[model samples]
Target: MKNLIAATYAPMHPDGSLNLGMIPSYTTFLQSNSIEGAFVNGSTGDFVSLSTLERKNLIAAWAKDKPKDFFLTNHVGHTNLNEAKELAAHSQGLVDAICVLPPFYFKPKTLESLLFYCAEVAKSAPDTPFYYYHIPVLTGADFNMLDFMKLAVEQVPNFTGIKYSQYNPTDFGKCLHFDQGSKNILFGVDEQLVDSLPLGATGWVGSTYNHLAPLYYKIISSYRNGDIEQAKLLQQKGVFFVQTLDKINGFNGAGKSFMRLFGLDMGPSRYPHKTMTDKQLALALKLMEPQEIAPLFNTSFSVKHLQAIG
Candidate 1:
């Protein structure tokens, strides 16, 4: 969690069935490419589209005898409180942490209501550390983290941190400094990660990190060495990577398909998510080539070969 923790994609068959078999290779790929951990069954995994059993299967596969340092955080939040609690309870001995988006459908209006939802899920896995997934765009629950930190600390005993995925630096800064900087606020926006480093962010969890770990590590190194131009330039490649795919066939769908370029074919995307054609992937790769990120997509390259070159 200290560095880039990839919010991993759901591996699937052509018909969109879960493909657990890819995990062994998946683990090896992440390790070799310098990805520290995974945030499993999350937005990147299309958690909302998955059934309870499907989600359970995903957690089970990822949690089963994983490498000791290959941390797994399960996103067990569900619209149905009972189902969420069940997932939370089921993940007790399996994961390093559990994160939950607010119940987006009905939505929590007050601070207490949000805490109540989190408390229930937290109670189910009392031994586990609880991280509130604070992606306001998706959840529509825009409760201020500064407020959440105060309330969560008082009530949720295992309230460890937040998967902060918004653009509001003011609230993010407040949460980061809450209780003298004890909180673990894992930044979630891949495009804006460089902005967080100056704000004292140490950990990040994001979807693009799955494909661009070497690039991000390079961005971190560049920024730390007072190389702002290099850092910004690297980040723009990610921004372009996302923005370009988003235009052609939606980022999630095309991006999932783009994993094939990285030696991990995640299969076709699910409903409301389209699969990118080979032609589309070719177009995407063409754009990435100039940025020098195209070569790092495949695992055939060695770790020694992965020197960041953007």
Candidate 2:
């Protein structure tokens, strides 16, 4: 939570089965890029598409291979309350923390009901720190997080804070200052990260961090160094990076496919998410090169190709 925590992709084989074998390499890649942790089974992992057993298996694989220092938060959210608790219980000792999105389908009508649901899931993993994944756009359960946290802290003993993914900076800023900044309110929007920094956002969880950690770190350093213009410029690159991939194919699939540029073949996107063709991928790289963004990709990419473009 101190720095960037990647919302990891679930590696799959061509057949779309869980390619858990790729996890060890995935871990090394993240650590190499200085990503603080992995937020598994979240949006980027396509968790809803994965079965309960598949989600459990994915967490187990990450836990088994993750380096001692790597922080892993298993997103054990399920529409079914029983299954969510089951996954929470399963993640007890394996992960550094456990996270749960509000059940998206039925949707919680009131903050009290949302609190009830979170408290139930949190108690299932009593010993592990619990985080409420507040992504209202997808969940359709939009509650004021600052108000919810005021109640949640009193209700749920293990409730650490929120993964505030929505675009409400005023509320996000309030949540950050709640109780003099006691809770860990991780900002979830990548494009808005630089803006969030001035609002006291220290931690972030996003999919872009997987491919562009170096660029982001540079952004952070530039901001810290008082180079505001450079920071803004770098952040715009991030925004453009996401937009470019999103244009080639849906960003979720194209971005995951872009991992191959780092030498980690994360494989095809499952149903409903388009996998980029080789030509599409080449176009993605081509699009990034002129923006001066390609140079910031991981060193694992062919230096020759990068230089040739340079």
lDDT of 1 by residue, 234-297 (tens): 8888898899899989998887887776567789899999998878876776666777776545
Candidate 1 clash pair list: none
Could you tell me every candidate's TM-score relative to the true structure? Answer: 0.95, 0.96
TM-score of 2: 0.96
lDDT of each: 0.87, 0.90
Worst 10 residues of 2 by lDDT: 301-310
User: Please, what are the lDDT tens digits per residue for candidate 2 over residues 164-210?
Assistant: 99889899999999999999999999987888888888999999989
Task: Give the number of the best model, judged by lDDT.
Answer: 2
User: Could you tell me which residue pairs clash in candidate 2?
Assistant: none
Model 2 bad stretches (over 4 Å): 303-310
